[model samples]
Target: EKTVVLITGCSSGIGLSLAVRLASDPAKTYKVYATMRNLAKKERLLDCVKGLHKDTLDILQMDVTDQRSVLDARQRVGEKRVDILVCNAGVGLMGPLEAQSLDTMRQILEVNLLGTISTIQAFLPGMKTQGHGRILVTGSLGGLQGLPFNEVYCASKFAVEGVCESLAILLQHFNIHVSLIECGPVNTNFLDNLQAAEPGSSGEQVDARTQSLYEMYLQHCGTVFQNAAQDTDDIVKIYLEAIQSASPAFRYYTNSALLPITSPKTAASDGLQYIKTMSKIIFSTNNKVEQK
Candidate 1:
């Protein structure tokens, strides 16, 4: 029997690739319900899966940020059974912390944190009752270690990291597995979405030193992604492994180059040393960025 899968944020990026990859499986092992916030944006997904077997994939409309939409989407799934639930729908917010409005931060939390929870809640009962299920969330390497100028975005992913980890322990008894796909920079529209959030006047009001720090951070960020970012396919492969494993890992890091960002926390007895070390690394990088 094919595993029935429901994946959110499938209009593009890893979600789109994963949906197409599974739906096009030569072995016919996966039946995919690929969902997004708008059906109008589904052209890319349809085009990507064009030559693949059509019967394996169906496009659905669901906004992960909206609980009603989540519940309604679950209802639309055939038999209301979800063998694998991919909580991949999320938005990004990046800018100076002072410039990020409270409302925008809340929106990030709603989609990244609450959205994952709501989606999981909608399908948890079925998974538990069936005696087994897989829950995969697209977390971030940034979630493990905070990055400068990503205060709100990092906070949202950090919360999700906690949620998935806690759920892993709580749901394992039911034979349901929860995994966090801790990703580094991947080529995705997430950056575009992050820039689309409204700006605050702090951009105008901030002093020169603050502005310099932000500019240096952006420059360093551009170089990091350009040099080390993984393609969407790379991440899809990792997710596939998590899906197929009989006993899956709780956390899977997609980018190893960024692993150093997370190591200091555990390397120190109190984590204060970790904080100091990370700060120094960040400032040193920015200093070089400033020289250029």
Candidate 2:
């Protein structure tokens, strides 16, 4: 029996890549339910699969933010059970906190935090009944450590960490595993897709200092992505590790080089070290550029 894998956010990025890889497995080991918020965006996924996945792949419309849509997608699953549930649906928000509107923050939280919980909730009972399952979440570095200009995004991801950690303890008894694939920057359209606050675009006026810092942050982001961003294929290899392992860990880091940046958070119990280190890592270069 092929593993029934259902992944969200299949329109593009990690979700789309994973779906394509698993569906095209040489042994035909997986039946992939690749879902996205809009069916209109599915052509990209289809084009990548090359129309040969008739039996191995199926596309469904699922907006993780909408509970009804999640439930409806579950109903459409042909296998009637999801052996591996990949909650890869999420969005990013970036800007100074003062510049971000309340509605925008809520939207990020709804999709990144609540959307994940809702999707898992829809399938939790079925997994428990089956007595075996794997829950995989696409996590972010921002989720593990704070980042400038991403307050709301970090909050939502931090909440997901709590949710998964708490659930892992209980799910273990049911022969169900929950794992988070914590990623650094990846080569994807995520930067373009995220909602970022433009200086002076919002009603509130952000202070000049914050604006300068935001610009520095954006440049820092660009440098980091260009220098260190992993491709989606690299991320997929890590996901496969977790999936194929007999005992998957609760958290898997995709970019180990980036892991040290998070260590200060744990290395110093006071937690101020991470903040200072991250600030220096990101802003120090810009600080020098400005002086020159």
Candidate 3:
């Protein structure tokens, strides 16, 4: 019997790539339910899979923020059970905290935090009943460590970490595993998709100092992505490792090089070290660039 896998955010990025890879497995080992918020954007997923995945792949409309949509998608699963559930639907928001509107922050929390919770909630009972299942979440570096212009985004991701960790303990008793694939920057459209408040546009809402810092942060972001971003294929390999492991770890770091950056957070219990270190890494480097 093939593993019945369902992944959210299938319109593009890691979700789309993972779905395509699994569905096209040479042994036909997986039946993938690739879901997205809008069915209209599915052509990209279809275009990548071609017409050959008739038996191996199914596309469903699932808006993770909507509980009803999540339940409906679960109902559409042909196998009646999801052996592997990948909650990959999430968005990013970047800007000074003062410039970010309440609605925007809520949207980020809804999708990144609550959306994940709802998706898992919908399938948790089934997994518990089956007595065996894998839950993999697409996590971000921002989730582990705060970023300069991503306050709301980091908060949402941090909440997800709490949710996954909390659930992992209980789910283990049911023979179910929960794993988070913590990623660094990736070669995807996530940067494009994220809602960013341009410093110029924010005008008086953001003070000049903050505006300058935000621009520096953007530059630092660009340099990091250019130098260190991993491809989606690399991330998929980590996902496969967790899926294939008999005892999967609760967290898998996609970029080991980036792991050290998070160590200060743990090494210094007060959390001041991480903040200082991150600021120096981002702002100090940009300051040097400016001096040159």
Which candidate leads in TM-score? 2
Candidate number with the higher TM-score (2 or 3): 2
Give the alpha carbon lDDT tens digit for every residue of 46-106 in model 3: 9998887989999999999999999999999988999999999999999888887767778
lDDT of 2 at 21: 95
Question: How accurate locally is residue 159 in candidate 3, as Cα lDDT from 0 to 100?
Answer: 91
Show where candidate 2 strays beyond 4 Å. Answer: 200-202, 286-292
Clash totals in order: 0, 0, 0
Q: Give the TM-score of candidate 1.
A: 0.93
Lowest lDDT 10-residue stretch of candidate 3: 196-205
RMSD for each of the candidates: 2.6, 2.2, 2.4
Best by lDDT: 2
**Backbone clash total, candidate 2:** 0
Rank by TM-score, highest first.
Answer: 2, 3, 1
Candidate 1 lDDT over 160-232, as tens digits, reads 9888888888998999999989888999987887743344444435557877887777777788789898999
Instruction: Flag regions of model 3 displaced more than 4 Å.
Output: 198-204, 286-292
lDDT of 2 by residue, 19-135 (tens): 999999989999999999999999999999898798999999999999999999999998899999999999999999888877888889999999999999999999999999999
